[model samples]
Target: MPKMKTKSGAKKRFKVTASGKIKSGQAGKRHGMIKRSNKFLRNARGTTVLSAADATIVKKYMPYAR
Candidate 1:
């Protein structure tokens, strides 16, 4: 079989943590900050682990990320 081609966009957007969790930047911070509360901004400042269901999808795009 041929080697699988990793998704270029996924490789740049998602990261495989040391523990194997998929980490990506928090959502809802791209715009509309005026409507977003200070607490939300603070809490969503860094990357977050993708939910198990969501991680499964990302994993497909990054076969070798495991």
Candidate 2:
């Protein structure tokens, strides 16, 4: 049987941690920084774990991640 292919876009954007959580960069920071508040920028500075609903989708894209 053919091997399952991982989604290239998901591979670059999401990371599966050792404990099986998905780590991804903050969203909404690509443009319009001036319109955003300081607090939003501060809180979105680093990676955040995906919620259960989102992680399930990512898991399908990255079958070998776990």
Considering every candidate listed, which one attains the maximal TM-score?
A: 2
Q: Supply candidate 2's per-residue lDDT for 61.
A: 96
What's model 1's overall lDDT?
0.95
Cα TM-score per model = 0.92, 0.95
Report lDDT (CA) for all predictions. Answer: 0.95, 0.95
Clash count in backbone of candidate 2: 0
Q: Per-residue lDDT of 1-50 in model 2, one digit per residue for the tens?
A: 99999999999999998999999999989999999999999999999999
The sequence of per-residue lDDT tens digits that candidate 1 reaches over residues 1-66 is 998999999999999999999999999998899999999999999889999999999999999989
**Model 1, 41: alpha-carbon shift in Å?**
0.6
Relative to the true structure, candidate 1 reaches a TM of 0.92
State the lDDT at 12 in candidate 2. 95
RMSD of 2: 0.7
